[model samples]
Target: MSRLVDAHCHLDFSVFAADRAGVFERAREAGVESFLVPGTTRARWPDVVAMGAREDVAVCLGLHPCFMDAHDDLGDIAALSEWLDRHPEVVAIGECGLDARFADSWHAQWSLLEAQLRLARARRLPLVLHCVHANDVLARRLRQLAPPAGGLIHGFAGSPEQAMAFYRLGFVLGLGGATTYPRAQRLRRTVAALPDDGYVLETDSPDMPLAGHQGERNEPARVAEVCRIVAELREQTESRVAADSTATACRLFALD
Candidate 1:
């Protein structure tokens, strides 16, 4: 419990707005040192950028697949360029990827994903990706584009082979609350067996709560619990898991 990073969390989301400072305080008390807040649409990038002013937090901006209809115009990509120019300290390009659950908007998702991939390449920043039942397409796209900064496939709960598919293409899987569920035996085993460098920890907060907190709002503090569960699953000390995953996120986001 020395030091840890919540590699992905939406701290700017409405759930934490009333007590965001308290959330950070609680997380730091639990050994969570830094939190990466990813933007899900152009509209929220400003709020995320505002949060980036805090030394302990990092930010990434992109249009999320589930919010496909919200991206009003193609110029949002241009707006993204403007945001990056104005906020060069931003860590990565993401929370972007395909969601098979939204297959009807697959074409729009592809267009946004492609543009963001290119933007991440141009910005020389890593990506925070989200894919649901779309690994093959995501893998193919990553292989084709080969982003130089690489990326993290956020909230990965797939098989080890599937995780390796992303690793082979210069991406890493993100392990989170998903590992804390007893029924997630396959995912837990996948997380345990992967090479230490192949993944980072996350919470995707206010969304994917851990097993016991099914109805409560997830805070970055809970990531410390995630670290413990990951350590248990991997049969390593929590300190080891904390250090390794922190290092992985630091490298990916170019955090000093």
Candidate 2:
């Protein structure tokens, strides 16, 4: 079996509430040996941390931009910094970034993102960004900060030119089920053009399901299907994509 990793997921979400254990077991059987769960809220940080304690799970802590309305206090950023200081299991700082698509207040979103970026830099940990239709703003901020340690752009659907900008800023493009859809022409093209060394594989489970399973909830086990599609697009074998992506993820998170 080709060893693989699901670089980003939200196992704490209620989608896996009934049989989370079974979901993980099925993922392992599919050759997804490790999973990274990123926290999106202060209250969920403990649950996220607990999930990471499981044999093959790793965790990242940060407030997601979608929940900007929820983070009224910037103190949560400090709390996360303290948490990172104490917890060795916490691998990175994010699932946080600017999302101008759904929210009305870009200032609040940018504030939260900038604070988290500072925390990640101070802690010397990588970031797990969640950018949505704001890659230009994201790229600009990343350039200004130039964090010594880099991170991954989860669920990237930008153009090849935009992707190259991120690559120049030392970020990895996280590819997932979005590229599997025949209708996602631009995304497919971007994924096809990405360099093997500049990408990582993810499922973003309970969210971006593969083409055939579009309406169904996604699971970590389906990452292999994603790899197969990516490999086909890149004109490479599944084993090669799986091995290279897993290595890229390991290096990003400093996994042993």
Candidate 3:
């Protein structure tokens, strides 16, 4: 089988602190060779960057829209820019975007998201964006802001049309545990119809567990199952799906 890449997983999060090494070991054992871990807040950037020391780990730093409390009105964005400058090896700028769940902070989310978008644009880095209940709004924002280095829309469960909108904007969808569920018809259809370069496999570790593993902490190792289901959805061989998705991830994140 071709090696797989978990394009989005929070291995740096505290949930994996006790056995992070074991997590990586199992992932590699399961044929997952690389991971992209995105930082969700200023407080976590150090841990996120530190994970990059591992040969198989790549990092992206940005203040997530869900954690506005962890961000400052001025310093965080500037600090993120400086951090990226200091850590030139950092792969992208995000884990950032709008979330409707935090609607009260909607404007603030847009402010922070736009700031990160600008940073990614200025640096010519790809972004690992997160959007919830705002694809139309986000598509509009991307069109207007025009950040050129397309990124992944992590944990994408949007419609096929929505997926294509992001693809047209240079972004690819991160298909994760959600696709493993039989009831996720919309996402499955999106997966089936995705352009050759339109999507990548992800686990969103410790959060989006696969169908049979509900309530279990997800890990990078589970991405192999994601690949399996994706292959089934696309009516392609598992190795083909794994190879194509891994290649797309390498190209998107500039991984070696």
Candidate 4:
């Protein structure tokens, strides 16, 4: 397969602490040449930044919507702006987006998300969105906000129409372990239907384990598996999927 990129992964998470070096080594052995790691909170921004120091890794800093409690009294939005100013090497602004599952913080989620969207626009940086059950709302917001840098909707699991909606907004979808399962009929169809530049492959490591690997810690090396499944769904060769997805990710993030 052509060189691959993990468009989104939390390789900074403590779960990988003991063998993080091996993780990178294994990913490189699997042909994954780059990783985009997004920070989920202010607390981990430093670690995420440190991880980005690696030549093969890029990073994003933002307050994840699910972790509202972490941002609550910390002025994290302003801090995120400052962090971006200080870390010009940072590639994007997220792991941030609306998730309807946290009902109590629904309104707060919108508030924080809008702030980050504005930051992305002002900084002229792409985003790494983490949306769940809020695609319609997010699409509308993106239309209104119009972050020129455009971004990736990481771990996308929606209909073809939804994927097209994001593509129209200058954002590309990130296909991960979710598409490996037979149960994800709609997602697999979306994978087959996407335009040549409409999506990138991801692993969302230590989280969205691929089908048959449930309960195991996902890793960037598995992004090759994602490419294999995407190729099968699109009826293209794995090399083709790897090349197309890596190109899309490089373009979106301005990666070298």
Candidate 5:
């Protein structure tokens, strides 16, 4: 069986509240051996940690840019940093980045994002970025900050040029359910063009459900289907996609 990894997901969200354990079970049955759950706010850290404590999961902690308005105090940043120092299960520092598509407050987004970037740098942890219509700005900041250990650009839907840019920064492109859509021509083209070692696969489960699975909540079990699509696009076997992407994830997050 192909051993795959969902490099980024939010299993801590309420969407999976009813059957979170069952979700992981199905994923294992589908040959998806591991997954990463990223925290979107300070309050979710405990739950994120709890989920990661499970046998085959890892956790990433940081404030997502889309939820910048949720944080009332900067002390949360300090708390996250302290938590990172204390937890070996904390694999990276993110779910953070600029999101110009959703909100108009560019300044506020940058402030929160840059602060998290600094925290990731300080802890020497990989970042799991969430850029939406802001790849240029994200690339610029990545160049400037140059975090010692780079991370994954989760849900990547940018141009091949943009993919090359992030790849140069030691960042891996995270291809997920979006690429499974028949109309995601540009994304498919980007995936086809990317080097085998340039990305890690993900499901972004309970959100970004695959094309045929639209309207149905996603789960990590569908990650293998994602690998199949990516492999077909790249003219490679599913096992090759799964193995390479899993290795990329392990190397990026320092997973054993």
Candidate 6:
């Protein structure tokens, strides 16, 4: 089978710090040769950049809403801009978006998201967005902006229509561990029905472990399982899912 991209992960995070190199090796052997590690806060950008420097890893720079306190001032935008300008290796503009499911500061989250969204558009980079319980606003903003560089809505768990909203606006859904759950009929159905190019496989590694691996640390290698599940849901073969999802991610991130 052709190699696949673990479209979203946090290998730089402490969870994999002890054996980061080993983690990549295992993933590579599992047929996941490329990885996209997105920044979650200013403090971790350096580590993320260092990881991105590797031949097989790509990175995205942005502040996630769950860590709203990390982006105190709008200064993060300036810093991210400078970093992105200096680092052609940076592939996308996010890991940023609203997290109404967990964060109490929804307004602050939206404000921060807007700043990054504008930066992403200005730089002509697709965004690696993370939205939880806030698709209405996310879709609305994207409609207004119409960014030329499309992106992935990572860890997608929405309906077919909701998934189509992003697809129509040049964004594709990221399918991950959630699809492995038997109870995730809705999400699985969405992945199965969406246009073949409208979704990509992600592990969201060091988090979102598959159903059987619950309570364990997720790694890029597990994305292969995600691909399998997506294939099963779509009633297609594993190889087909791998090739299609990889091509879609390559286009969105300019990973040529």
Model 3: clashing residue pairs?
none
lDDT (Cα, tens digit) per residue for candidate 5, span 1-256? 4588889889999878988878888988999888889999998999999988786889999888878668753787778878887887798888888888766767887888888888888878889999999998889989998998999999999999999999999999999999988898999899999987899999887888998998998899999889999999999988899889999998998777
Q: Which candidate model has the greater TM-score, 5 or 6?
A: 6
TM-score of 1: 0.97
Over 139-226, each residue of candidate 4 has an lDDT whose tens digit, in order, gives 9989998999999998899999999999999999999999999999999999999999999999999999999999999999999988
Locate the minimum summed-lDDT window of 10 residues in model 4. 69-78
TM-scores for candidates 1 onward, in order: 0.97, 0.97, 0.99, 0.98, 0.97, 0.98
Which residue runs does candidate 4 get wrong by more than 4 Å? none
Worst 10 residues of 2 by lDDT: 68-77
lDDT of 5 at 35: 85
| lDDT, candidate 6, at 75 | 85
Candidate 2: which stretches are off by over 4 Å? none
lDDT value, residue 189 of candidate 4: 94
Poorest 10 consecutive residues by lDDT, candidate 3: 65-74
What is the C-alpha local distance difference test score of each model? 0.89, 0.89, 0.93, 0.93, 0.88, 0.90
Question: What is every candidate's alpha-carbon RMSD to the true fold?
Answer: 1.0, 1.1, 0.7, 0.9, 1.2, 0.9
Q: For model 3, how does the per-residue alpha-carbon lDDT over 179-199 read when each residue is reduced to its tens digit?
A: 999999989999999997888
User: 37 in model 6: Cα distance from truth in Å?
Assistant: 0.5
